[model samples]
Target: MSKISVTELNKISREIRQDILDMVYTAQSGHIGGSFSSTEIVTALYFSEMRHLDPADPKRADRDRFVLSKGHACPVWYASLCKLGYFEKYHLSSLRKINSILQGHPDMKSTPGIDCTTGSLGHGCAAATGMALEGLMAKDGRRVYSILGDGELNEGVVWETAMAAAKFKLDNLVFFVDKNNLQMDGTSDQIMPLFSIEDKFASFGWNVLTIDGHNMDQILESLKVARNTKGKPTCIVAETVKGKGVSFMEDVRNWHGKAPSKEEFESAMAELTA
Candidate 1:
C-alpha cells in the first residue's frame, strides 16, 4: 500500500462517491446511503492498506483479506476494488444487474476479490473470525479486516462473534463498526439502543479505537495501531453519517436502499464533481 496524503485520499473519496452514485443509479435497485457512508473506509482499506493478492490470485492463502460484513453496502467495496485494479472499471456499472458478478450482496465465488459470500447481516463477523483464526494457526502474517454496520450489531450473532473473537485471541483480525446510528426502521437508539458500542466491545476483551470514519488520517492511524496489537482482536468504531457526501442523502432513511432518480443522480454527480 502506498502512503497517501489526506488531500489525495480526499480526492480518491470523491471518485468513490461518484462510483457509488453511478452504480446505484445504473442498477436502479441497490443500497445507496450505506454505500456512501462506507466509501471512505473501504477506500482506505483497499487503496491505502491491505496487501499480497493480485487480481489473478485473490484467493491465495497468504493474502490479506477483507470481508464486507455489512454486505448490502458492497457498492463501496466494489468501487474500491475496481479503482485498485481488481477488475475493469466498466464492471462497476453492471452492479445488481441480472447475472452480474456484482450481486446485490457479495459472493466470493462470483467476484474475484471478495473472500466470503455475505448478505445475512451478522454472519460476516463470524466468518472473518474463522479466517483470522486460520491465519493464526498457519502463523501467517496476513490480516483479516471486516467492516460491520452499527445497525447490524443489533443481531445476537454479532456479540457471539465478539465473544468468540476474544476467546480465540485473534490479534490478526480487525473489525470496523460503521457507526452511522441508523437502521432501516429508524435511528439505532430507537430500534435497540446500542448506547455505547465502544464500551460493549471493550467489555468483550478487545482493544477498541474510535475515529471519524471520513477522516483519512485517523482511519490510517487506527489501522496502524490495529496492525500492531498483540494477542487480542481490535475493534474500531468508525463514527459516520448514513449518507456522507451528497446533500440530499445525508442522514436520510428514505435513501437507504433506494436508487436516486435520474435528476437526483445528475445533481449528485455534479456536486461530487465540483
Candidate 2:
C-alpha cells in the first residue's frame, strides 16, 4: 500500500468523525465523545501507520494487529475498518443493532478485521500485551497497537499489563493513551486525577512520548519513534479534545455517551463537512 500524506489522512479523519456522529444519531446510543477524540489516532494507524493489512485476508499471518482498548469508542474503529474496505459501508449504519457485527464493542468472531473482542475496560490492553508476546515468542516481526482511554488507567488490571509488558521487554507493543481528559462522568481530574500519564509509563519501564493527538505530523512521528524504539514498549500519551471537530460537543462531558438529537446531529454533520 502506498503511504498516505498528512493532508489526505486529515480528510479521512473528518470522514470518520462524520460516520461516528451519523452512527450514534441513527442508533440513539453510542459513545461519541471519545470516539471523536481518538479519530485521528485511529486514522493514522489504519490509513498511514500500520502495515500488511488486507481487507480480504484480514486473518493473514504476520499482519499487524490493533486493539481498541477503550472499547466503547469503537465507532471510530468501525468507521476506519469500513473505510479500509474490511467490510461494506452499509454495515456502518447497522452499528449497535441487535446481531450487528458492529456492536457496542468489538467482537473478533463477527468482525472481519477486529483482532480481539473488547469492551471490558482494562481487558483489551491485556489482550494486546499477550498478542505482542505471542508474536515475540513466534519470532514474527509483527507489531501490535492499541488505544487506551486515560480514565481506563484507573483500572488495576491496566497497570498490571503495563508491568508485564515492561517485564517482558515487549518493544513490539505500542499503545496510545487517549488523554482527552474527559470520561463518562466528568473531567478525568474530577473523576480520578491521573497526575502524569507519561511519567506513569516511564516509571513502568516503557519508552514514553507525548504528542497532540489531533496533529497528523505528531501522530505519525510518534508511531515512527515507537517502531524504532528497542528494549521496552512505547506509550504515546495523546492530548486531545473530547468530541473533537464538532463545535457543540467539544469538551462537553454530557456528550460522552449521548446520541445527538436531530438538530445536534445536523449541526455536527455540518461542522464535520465543513
Candidate 3:
C-alpha cells in the first residue's frame, strides 16, 4: 500500500478534529480533550494504515482490527469511523443518547466498524492479544492494532498482555500508547510515574518505536517499520498533549471527559478552523 503523505494526513486530521467537536458539542457529553490529542494517531490508522472490510461486513474475520484500550477517549475512533464511511455523519450527533450506536464506550454489536466493546481501561489490549493469537493459530494474516493511554498503563493487565504478546511472538499485533502525560485526575507522574515507555516495551521484547503522535510522517514511517518487522510484536510510544489544537483545552485535566457548551463549542470551532 502506498503511504499517505504528511500533507494529506494533516488534512484528514483537521477534519477528524472537527467531527469530534461537532459530536461532543451535539451530545453535550463526551471526552474532547483526549479525543483531540489522539486525532492524528487515529486518523493515520483508520484512513491510511488499517485495512478493514466494508463497515456493513464488520464481522469479516479477514479484516484488520483496532481495539481502543483507552476507550474513554473514543471520540477520535468514532470520528474516524464516520469519515471512513462506517456510518452516516448524522448519527454522530446522537452520541451517548439512549439507544444510539454511539455509546459512552465502543460496542461491537451496537456499532459497526467497532471490533470490541471497550470502556474499562487496561483490558482492551489483552483481548486484542487473544485475537492476534487466534489469527496466528488460524493461519490468517490479519493484524491487530490496539491503542492504550499512558495512564491506562497503570493497570497491570496491559503489561500482562504485552508480556504475553512477546512470549508468543505475535508479530501481527501492533500496540500504541498515547503518552499524553496527563490522566483524568492529574498528570501520570503525580498519579503514577511512568519511566520511559519505550524502554519498558523494548525490555518486554517488542520492536519499539517512539515518535511525536501528531507528526503524520513520523507516525506513518514508524508504523511501516513495525509492519515489516518479524518475530515480535511492535509497540509505538506516541507522545501527545492531553488536549491538542485548542489552546485552552490543551493539557487541561478538566476537559478529559467534559463536553463543550454552545458558546464554548463555537469558540473552539473558530480556533480549530483558524
Best by lDDT: 2
RMSD of 1: 1.0
Q: Which stretches of candidate 3 lie over 4 Å from their true place?
A: 1-3
Which residue ranges in model 2 land beyond 4 Å of their true spot?
Answer: none
How does each model score on lDDT?
Answer: 0.90, 0.93, 0.88
- For each candidate in turn, the TM-score is 0.97, 0.98, 0.97
**What tens-digit string does per-residue lDDT give for candidate 1 at 123-166?**
99889999999999998788999999999998999999999999
Greater lDDT among 1 and 2 belongs to: 2
1-274 per-residue lDDT for model 3 (tens digits)? 2466779889988888888999888888889988888888888888788775577677787888899998988888888888778899888988999999989899888888898889999889999999999999988789999999999999999889889999999999999889899988999999999989888899999999999999988998988998899999999999999879988899899999998888889998998888
Where is the poorest 10-residue window by lDDT in model 2? 48-57
Model 1 ranges with Cα > 4 A deviation = none
**What TM-score would you give candidate 1 relative to the actual structure?**
0.97
lDDT digits (tens) for residues 69-117 of candidate 2: 9999999999999988999999888988999999999999988899999
Best by TM-score: 2
User: Candidate 2 — what's its lDDT?
Assistant: 0.93
Angstrom error of the Cα, residue 216, model 2: value is: 0.4
Clashes in model 2: which pairs?
none
